[model samples]
Target: MAIGWLSILKAVPWTDVVSNAPKVADGAKKLWETVARKKAPTGTSASATSDTSSPAGQEARIAELAGELDRLQQEMLASSQLLKTLAEQNAQLVRRVYWQSRLLLVVGLIAVAGLTLVLLR
Candidate 1:
């Protein structure tokens, strides 16, 4: 199982992922900000305002549609925030993995050098 996982990890291009992580994070941040800053539709449509003489049933329907619009906007904002959070976490994980891979390389080099020195003696 561990070998399978290692093979999958090895298949990934870490350098490319590390390089693009910041871009992904930035895009997510921008998306979240854009969604958050958007103003929700005010529950008053032009028809609703101009047609005060209209029947009460029509007015109620307009109000219901407006409520639904507001709910959708709220849901969109929430989804954007979640996406931003996930992107940031992914970037952080990529950075950590990059550093760990570098450390492992250094440690392997040191071990090889030590073995060479011992064999030479």
Candidate 2:
């Protein structure tokens, strides 16, 4: 089986910064995490105890991890998309406001010029 980036992200314990349980931020990271966990026994050594796990049990655990990776990926993608949209909208608003400011400046100058000419007359 080929381990991908998404697997790795999913496997990282997310509690270091965010929550009590580890949450994978991206699917790509999750994939890589999954791969790393399966290939390296260094991780989860403490969890291996109690003598009930067989090959099938390990497989079940892997399946569960895979599902978690998928869920996290979905969440990350959704959040990223929303942020992108918001950024674009912000940029557009800034542009509009900038133009409006320029227009007001020009109109103000015109009014000032008219008043000065009438005063000279």
> Candidates' TM-scores?
0.58, 0.57
In the range 1-121, model 1's lDDT, one tens digit per residue, is 9997995587456776778678667766766775677666656677667665567856877787787788677767767766776776677767777877787789999999999999999
RMSD of candidate 2 to the true fold?
16.7
Candidate lDDT scores, in order, read 0.73, 0.59
**Best candidate, TM-score:** 1
Candidate 2 lDDT, 3-121, residue by residue in tens: 75554444343433354113324533555555454433334555654322778767877886787778667666765755665565556556655665677689899999999999999
Please state the error at residue 25 of candidate 1 in Å: 20
Q: What's the distance in Å from true for residue 29, model 2?
A: 25
